[model samples]
Target: TGYGDDHTREIMRQELRERLIQAEREGRPLRVYCGYDPRTTDLHLGHTITMHKLRQFQEFGHHVIFLIGSFTSLIGDPDDVKAREILTPEKVAENAQTYKEQAFKILDPKKTEVRHNSEWLAELGFLDVIKLAQHFTVQQFLAREGFSNRLEDGNPIYLHEFFYPLMQGYDPIGLKADAQVGGQDQLFNLMAGRQLMQKLGVQPQVVIAMGESLPGTDGIEKMSKSKGNHIALLSEPGQMYTSLMKLPDFAMPLYFKLLLGWSQEDVDDMMVRINRGEVEPQEVKAGMALDITTIFHGREAALQGREFSRKAMQEGGIPDDIAEHVILSDTPLVDLLVVTGLCKSKGDAKRQIQGGGVRRDSDKVTDFDEIVRVTDLPTVLQY
Candidate 1:
């Protein structure tokens, strides 16, 4: 999952290689970790980059820790530029509850060790925080991409924001981690962890900043839940399949590499075949969708996903894989949309229907006051 310019990428690879060798030589499993801020309930496909790496470490017999940033989520990950809406303790706890199960989508649950930062971070006294703060400077934090963007855009960067990296730095020290896996944006935070560990007289961990972020279905910016452009791991097989199929043809190779872990040569060969008309791009995308879905939903579910895509997408027919939301009693179509998690709210559902974006079977939904029926139990709401 390592990513960056060639030189930096090579350095990270070499570092990880050496660390693994040392782990074998020392006859002790190297402690490897990746931290996730529990800011949301759903674990999206984009979030699985390091999770796959952590699984690799588990395969290699290294200790893998899946750390939940219960405390950090409140402060927000400084990697994202926008000011954060701090979550309440209740909200953070609720989100954390689902992380382990969702993470099992890629990680081996039995081999993985889970933790919440609040276990230790909440106990830190002011002096303890000051001691942690001494390792980094304002200039360094400001230089980070996210903070840099905020500064250049004249956005208010809060004082606690600077402490995020420092707090993250202390994670490795607390766990005595020997390596960290993270997104490209998290290189700064991982390096901070390395520095903090070294200061504490512990060996610095190897940092693997996984490859460049995958673009959203829009095929432009990185996938973000807020942008409504991410595929959540918790999404149904049909949802995942349809989402991946939404990418531009240009991004298929990247998806093949990032999501499927295919090599450059293989991706290039596949593209060459597609360019030569030796294979249909739609058929190739269907295979890509199936491969990804199988990882989370299994082969049977994946096959269903493929069939659904072929019918709903290719033949203008309803997908058999659509979740059956039984209507025990009648309700407004808008209310059903909100209930099924298809739309964010009843108002948004009504707006979509009015804008001709929502459809039932072959008919466009034009009325917000449309009532549902038991016959519509097998309904397909397309947006």
Candidate 2:
């Protein structure tokens, strides 16, 4: 969510209001779009912020384009300090396969028009690119934060990286979009679209830049898959619930607002109650976890996830439905941990054991070389 100041936000709001009236008079739905680059195989909760905005448009009978950045993903977004590794067309295609399925978890599939940017971007010839490039100056590109930061740090900014914004800007031209939604970090790119539309003699699209960024589980950095702080849309219900429950109490209000769409006033009231000792933060967090989990995994699964969390964390007991692994003979504890998916590897199991995090039947396993015999088959293991 990147609307810089209150004045700008107010202007955008007014413009949108007028545009809505104009569209209604024309008896046509406003064409709104948001693009997503399938850089990863799965979309995380952070990716859904703009999606939720798109859903609102769909609900209002507006036309929504779920544009996939098939061409742009090649260079990646130049929002990073350093140039991103280029992805092959094959890799980008593979990742794009599941994007729509995951997106449908939040979006109404019937109301959404899915398009790949490659349809238009790949058709642009060299002459077309040159004509597009004429609209912006090198100084303007250099003025962007990512490019400027890299320049100051003496980092190499690839010439191709400059073309990313141009390609993205051309999207609105191709789609004739009325409005675009994106994260605040994408403000510059969204502005590029508006500027390009004006120069090309087309009506500029309204930019609905989201002003809030979801913090990761760390409750500090923005939620990112690369940072290992993301909760993936495809995550198991129990895993998703546990991950949200791990967030710091300070991060709960934002999560409630962004994920649950709670109003600022409601979030403030909830925080006041928590501060006044009217309710336990854990209880509130549990409710949030359950509600959010229910969004993706259904109510029954979310309830089961809550039960699993309560058993493992609060009650210090295992869920009755926890996976059972039958062992016919004694096995190395480290080996068992890996086989049962308790640890990533033997080294991870050993480290967990060394840290006194590995437990059997509620007793901490201090030895890395400990064995799990047939006698311990019925015992519960906790990490």
Q: Per-residue alpha-carbon lDDT of model 2 for 1-383, expressed as tens digits?
A: 23477887788898899999999999999999999998888789988899999999999899999999999888888855788889998999999998998889999999999999999999999999999999988998888888988999999999999999999999999998999999888888888998999998998999899999999989989998878889888776666788888899999988999999999999999999999999999999999999999999899878876765555556536653455455668998889899989999999999999999988867899988888886543455777
Q: Model 2, poorest ten-residue lDDT window?
A: 315-324
True-structure Cα RMSD, model 2: 6.9
Error of 2 at 322 (Å): 13
lDDT of 1 by residue, 3-106 (tens): 25788778777987898788789999989889988888777888887888899889988899999998888877764567778789789999888799889989
Quote the positional error of residue 201 for candidate 2 in Å: 0.5
* lDDT of all predictions: 0.81, 0.87
lDDT of 2 at 263: 99
Residue 211, model 2: Cα distance from true site in angstroms: 1.2
Candidate 1, clashing residue pairs?
none
Residue 22 local lDDT, model 2: 95
